[model samples]
Target: MGAQKIVRQEADTVGENPLRLEKEKAEQIVDALNTDLADAYVLYHQLHKHHWNVEGAEHLGVHEFLEEAYEDVEDAADELAERVQTLGGVPHASMTALSEAATVEPEDEDVYDVRTSFENDIEMYGSIMESYREHIELAENLGDHATGELLRQHLLELEEHVHVMDHYLEDDSLVQS
Candidate 1:
């Protein structure tokens, strides 16, 4: 057999949750979370790309920071996937599903200077952070306090990285042109 199907939980459908949330509300939370999960993966890949291509002054520091940022995004995506499962929903696993669900736009495949890369990263992080804020409100509104709290924690780190990058982009840097 190629692969016999069993225990199917379609991505669009919600099953029973131990927390006893209403199916409709649970579905809303699932949709928001899946978007967050997709955005995190996109951020992870873009940051990884920047990490690989970074150059110029402070290249080592920028490269290392990109790795750290992407790792954090990867961890966040894992948590989001698990949270979807906990809420009795199937997480978006296919690249197409994720891309469809994602609200954040990633940079194109072309490599750029570290400044341009950080600028793009900052933009991506801003969108994800904004979505997290909205999702946190949605989760709390639906009495999914745990999910809200999870995104809140992630937001703090996201802000911290943006702050550091803002400093990096300050005009006091050693660039001649």
Candidate 2:
């Protein structure tokens, strides 16, 4: 052998590390977090798309609100991915992976109406909240306090977004009768 090449595998790739939690428990938590991360990413992109495409008298307001909402969601996605890495797991890297793992479905590109976008957002937020609660409980049960806390924080932010969207839906001015 004229030259020998050494291939290096990362902790995540090899699934070998000095994590204190049981490997199974860590994997479980990571899997849950990854799913949540996927949902967050999908929601973020949906919100951004709606922000740009939203049309009606309240278009400016809805666009600004969606911008803020998506920003928060982006932060949540980053934190979730970081938590997965901290737990000695690899976060999903591809759009296909994120889309496949996500529980929240994206709206069709043709659906650009403001009212429909808000309605879809509210529904998506509800689904994400449910997933967050489930993951939080699972993390707690598994003694992954860090993951639990991270999800709890995301839950609060998502709840705020839902509240805002609900208020918008309640606005009579926006409703067509």
Candidate 3:
């Protein structure tokens, strides 16, 4: 992939209003939230890609699962971006910015077995959960309750996703020998 040029937006002229949280703390939380948002966006696209291309013994099942997963991820990404705006920081809207900020790396668009796809998804969820945990801890330490709560919800959802993926792997019936 070619290197993407990142264009930074000019600072907004709106004077700081009266949010109780310290500006520095809020900025830190915003930074973390933006990263999470970018990761979510990338993951969303990955899930969508898999949804369209997945084929195997579990074709329909994996297809449907990816549909639901990507939808949920899209919603979560929107929420993360909105949270960044609420904290008075510009959300990373450009693909370049998102790619730069994201913790999730895009996978090669190669045909893979259902098992491999599931394994890749599981790994991605693990990385996302790790980032969520770190952000949650940082938010709580900064006394940014709202951001912490938002991240906690995401963390729970990601944990459930990981569990479901693990279950898929554990169930031998889901895999064709």
Candidate 3 error regions (>4 Å): 1-18, 174-176
Residue-level error in angstroms, candidate 3, position 1: 38
**What C-alpha lDDT values do all the predictions have?**
0.91, 0.85, 0.82
Scored against the true structure, residue 1 in model 2 reaches a CA lDDT of 50
Q: Give per-model TM-scores.
A: 0.94, 0.88, 0.88
How many clashing residue pairs are found in candidate 2? 0
Model 1, 1-177: lDDT tens per residue? 599878677677789999899888999999999999999989999999999998877889988888998898899899999999999899999999999999988889999988888899899999989999999999999999999999999999999999999999999967676
Each candidate's clash count: 0, 0, 0
lDDT of 2: 0.85
Residue-level lDDT tens digits of model 3 in 1-177: 999988554432122325677778887888889889989998888889889888768788778988988998988999998887777778888988898989888789886776787788888888999999999999999998878898898788778877877887776684557
Q: Compose the digit string of candidate 2's lDDT tens values, residues 50-89.
A: 9888877777888899999999999999999888887878
Clashing pairs in 3: none
Report the candidate with higher lDDT, 2 versus 3.
Answer: 2
Q: Provide the global lDDT of candidate 3 against the true structure.
A: 0.82
Best by TM-score: 1
Distance from true location, Cα of 160 in model 2, Å: 0.5
